[model samples]
Target: MPGYHSFTANIIYNLAQLGIPIRDSEFFDIQTYLEIVEIHKNVYAGETPSRQATQADIDTFLG
Candidate 1:
């Protein structure tokens, strides 16, 4: 939780550089990020980025 504020700040800065206006509300809430990261972690489990983790893997992990 302590470092998460930095993540949100970086997201805001990146979007702002693209001329996309963002409020703090636009950043993912902690719960949402946790959900998404859980999904991503499952997707990437037992694979490196070069390996292209699959939906099947995600489903398996979710299961």
Candidate 2:
């Protein structure tokens, strides 16, 4: 789960850049962090949960 941990860290870093306060411990577990990430990805893609995100959508969100 190291990769997931790294992903979570990146998300935390990005949120910090946006002036959002999020503690690493708040994620609780990898599943929780992943779910949050998915939700954010969907929002960034301007899609509903039922919609799949394209690579471009993911790239834009990552950037």
Candidate that would win on lDDT = 2
Best by TM-score: 2
Can you give the lDDT of residue 9 in candidate 2?
76
Per-residue lDDT of 1-63 in model 1, one digit per residue for the tens? 999999878756655644555664367665764565566567667685576669998899999
Worst ten in a row by lDDT for model 1 = 16-25
Using all chains and alpha carbons, the TM-scores for the candidates as numbered come to: 0.35, 0.40
Question: Which consecutive 10 residues in model 2 have the weakest lDDT in total?
Answer: 18-27
Model 2: what TM-score? 0.40
RMSD of each: 11.4, 10.0
Error of 2 at 14 (Å): 4.2
The residue pairs that clash in candidate 1, if any, are none
Misplaced by over 4 Å in model 1 are 23-63
